[model samples]
Target: MSDEQGFSPRERRASFTLAGIFGMRMLGLFMIMPVFALYGQDLIGFSPLWVGIVIGVYGLTQAILQIPVGWLSDRIGRKPVIYAGLALFALGSVVAALSDSVYGVAIGRVLQGSGAIAGAILALAADITREENRTKAMAIIGVCIGISFAIAMVLGPVLAAFIGLSGVFWTTALLALVGILMVRFMLPEQAHRGQIRDVTAAPELFGRLLKDRQLLRLDFGIMLLHLTLTAVFVAFPLTLLDAGLVAEHHWWLYLPTLLLSFVLIVPFLILGARRNMNKQLFQASILVMMAALLLMAAGQGQLWLLALAMMLYFTAFNFMEASLPAFLSMLAPAGAKGTAMGIYSTSQFFGAFLGGVLGGLLYQQLGGGGVFVLVAVCMAFWFWLATGMTNVSKVRSHILSIGVNIENKDQREQLLQRLMALPGVHEALIIPEEGAAYLKVDGNIFELDQARRLINL
Candidate 1:
């Protein structure tokens, strides 16, 4: 049943099913982005600030609970936590669907975020896939997320026009229910849990990762990226409206811009990955975003200009979204990747919340121009911080099992030194508690069979 890539049928099923479930959940979350500002204004107590709150409150809840929820999954079980999270999401969607006031909708958004199942779902995915195939499984999930975002952007306005905002909430609720059912029936139950050191966050490593300036900078970068993204959406729809684009026709702008931006980002991605220009490409992408924000602030009431700005913004956004994680993976300490990523994810959600609140406050006090200016300022700061980031080496992470009998500290250190002496090995750590050796290696020169034989000894 094994494929050429060594993935068994069950692993393949888990990967695709889990990816679909993640996609469905994200689709529900993103479907509200395009039309929330326009439609939210109709609710009671609908200030610009509340509109931003309603749009972003979910992130606040998500930020607070994602890590704890993952911890809970480890203690009880993955499926149970996933079920509870999805149920919470569905309940929140129903609440939003029934709300007549902005505050009510904000409450629902908070509940929606309380689901916070991302970590748990990823843990479950790790539990099921082989270590070597884990990256491929995660890539499948990543692709699903990208596709869901693209589809949601195009579909949000169209769905809003057809069914109204409440109906969109209802649809989201239904999607969450579907996700719950999939978890119940479709995913294979994990038998024995492996030490997924790379993917599952370890709480003990938080302080170390937080203090590492390199990882902290990357964390801040993700935060600022999502913050700017949310803040822009808070104002962008209104900008389109002022330029005479109707709510129903908004997709006309998003569809073409998104398509063109995807096309435009390919060259940068290629150069960054193929030519080892990631650092240069990363900095340039941020600069592009800053320029786009500046254009947005200055080009009020100009439809064509706004569209061009959006194209620039999305091109950079897409590139950064893809690149940041790769950078994080490369920069994370050998045993602390999960904790580093967990913090990064938390920062991202917090940024979304801050962006919503800041965007709303600025729009209310200083108008849409203020929102753009604020985002531009944040982007500039991000650019400054990014300049100090070191380029990570092109090393890949690998994990090998060590027998539990090798418990002595001297023996462990001796094994670690031997592993590090391998041709392609850059770093190796043998954790006696986990009975595994985590490695960073240049794959081109790393002799896998030789490493395996050494570990078995």
Candidate 2:
């Protein structure tokens, strides 16, 4: 049960568990994208604006609670929080399925967003897998998303055509329930790291994250990326339908386009990782995405042109999706991986919310071209911010959470200073209240035994 990258038995199993959970969750989302807007208009009191807001409401809820949920998972353990989120999401899906009005659907979507367990899921995966193997876990999740998006695009319109929007929501609810079952049966029960339990306040959790410029840039990039994605989907289907492509045949466009993008993305990611070309790949992908958006805006009323633009856009989109997390891993401070990811995930959801709300408004007024133009502008801003980031190699880092028993403030300070001075220690935070210190160190340069010897734990 080892991976190609040489994961141990536990790591391999955990990666598979994460892949399943992420895939199921994304399927619930992707199921809505292709037809939600058009079919949703038939729901009572459905305005174009309300439809867009409903589309994005989940992201808003997810954005607001992602950090808090991750923090809670750190304190209370991952599985319980995850189960709560899943139950909430399932409730939301059922509610949306039965709702007859846009407002009701909106409420359900927000609840669905509440079930977004990204932070908890990632932290749990991090707890189980070693740093060297973390990327593989992330990669498996990434592949699941890619697959889910492709399948969803293919299924969404057909399902909507046959059974309507309510059926889609019902199916989504079923998939979410299946995810809960998988978690119960497949995932291992692991203990939370007892260290770092004292720094539980929200302000303190996010305070350290606010200081890093590079991480902030990545956070901004994720927000804009999702925002652009949501915005484009808002208009793409209608535009295609206007160009004479039926909703049922939409998969004809998505399937090939997604496959092509995947082919392009994998090579680019390998090149970026091996050659340390992440910055270059990131910059180029953003530019490509911008061009694609502008092209879509200008190519309105022409189906072939729109398809070409979509091909270009998704190629860049897939590449960036795979690359950004890798970049975040490189730039984030060593000991606060969960904290750093919390902020990143929160921003992403916020961006998704904004994109849906704003895209819907723009479409109702200025139409498809306007939506594309707005997305392009967002990408331009992200590009400017990312260009200034320092180039970071794909070196692996570790967070060592060790228990401590210091009797006095002076003793704690002395221990903190000594740990910080260690040759490969990049950063260390000692919390006397928690009786533990979080250390970030280069795995290649530091020995785990050295810390054990220092603490004699």
Candidate 3:
């Protein structure tokens, strides 16, 4: 992605620093997911439903506050909002760590979610990176997220075994403080209004984005994915326990399953993407995932079989986590990607919230096996929707900074049409206010020089 000059040193600093910050925050959050179901039962007002509530409560607050916090960053600046969020996060961690009751823990989680800073972090990434290298920067942040999630899976168990859940919460609070230090000392102070349409949500654009069928499909897919994952975890930890895996040794199973799953995921993603078998592999993963869930349910007491099924489920889950965003960026209207993602993320969080409620309910009424069966049935419906999604041919985003804002509405519209007419530019949007043109390009056929000439960049 380098020209005569590659990503500026400052841009490199921004991406990596933000990624580290994001990962630290996510690591703390995810570490809770694996152990909560088991240890939470020790709380004063313990119940399966409250267990699920504590697990999923953060999602509800995160979904509600994420966009609004992003909007706040546009007014008060990124680091300020980021600092405030981290403070809130630390406070919540302390509250949870001190709480003996499940209700108190849930309240603490809600406070933690209120410190939603993902949008602000992304918006800051956009502020610092060049338009052309934006995707690379975003990809770095995304890769960090996946890595954090994997590490947390292992670390959560190890930490829980040594330190009680309160100790884990205290550790998260420390992580939040680390994030604040990184922001204050490591991150550069260069945030502006950051009116980046493709990296920050636009309230006006929400309506059209919501109505787009393709975008909705991706949204639905992400929502269901999170829902099933949260729901499964509600009972999965207990299932392993019932099957003779102690809470302390749970990491033994997770460590191997996660590692083995990673071994297959890269090749699977590469082969699928390269062969244009994305949709086929996507649907196949869904079916395999459904089967895996059922197998786990039926094979509960059989540890080895349960492990195999868990591995299969993770392979599918990891693949989709990578694929869905790519598909969304490909499907999103150029310049509207940010808003689309906001809605998509909200759907994801809301799904997690729903998962907790549903998982707890199903587990209470029908037990662990029923949770798997019912979730599989939900996935069957997801598969039907997947079959109808707009076939996602691979593409990537590029933006040309014309460096001169064109305020004329008619002229901007004409320029948009002209850019769209360019060969291999699958989608184009001209933002007159920003003096840039956002485009989704098929690199194989797109000629950069031709578009550069048209924009006189």
Q: In model 1, where is the ten-residue run with the lowest total lDDT? A: 191-200
Model 1 CA lDDT for position 343: 94
Clashing pairs in 3: none
* Candidate 1 Cα errors over 4 Å, as ranges: 192-195, 404-411
Model 2, runs deviating above 4 Å: 1-11, 127-139, 194-205, 401-425, 428-457
Per-residue lDDT over 1-457 for candidate 1, one digit per residue giving the tens place of the 0 to 100 score = 7965688999999999999989999899888888899887778899888878877889999999988887777778788888999999999999999999998888988999999998888888988887778889988998899889888988899999999999999999999999988988999877535335676688788888889999999999999999998889889999999989999999999999999999999898888877788888899999999999999999899999999999999999999998888889888878777778889999989998998898889999988899998899999999999999897657688777788536798888888888999999888877776678888888678987798888777
- The lDDT of model 3 is 0.87
Model 1: per-residue Cα lDDT at residue 433: 69
Q: After superposition, how far is residue 436 of candidate 2 from its true place, in Å?
A: 7.0
Error of 1 at 381 (Å): 0.8
Native-to-model Cα distance after best TM-score fit, residue 414 in candidate 1, in Å: 3.8
* Model 3 per-residue lDDT tens digits across residues 55-147: 888999999998888888888889899999999999999999999999889888888888999999999998888766788889999999989
For model 1, the local distance difference test gives 0.88
- CA lDDT, every model vs. true structure: 0.88, 0.79, 0.87
Per-prediction TM-score: 0.96, 0.87, 0.96
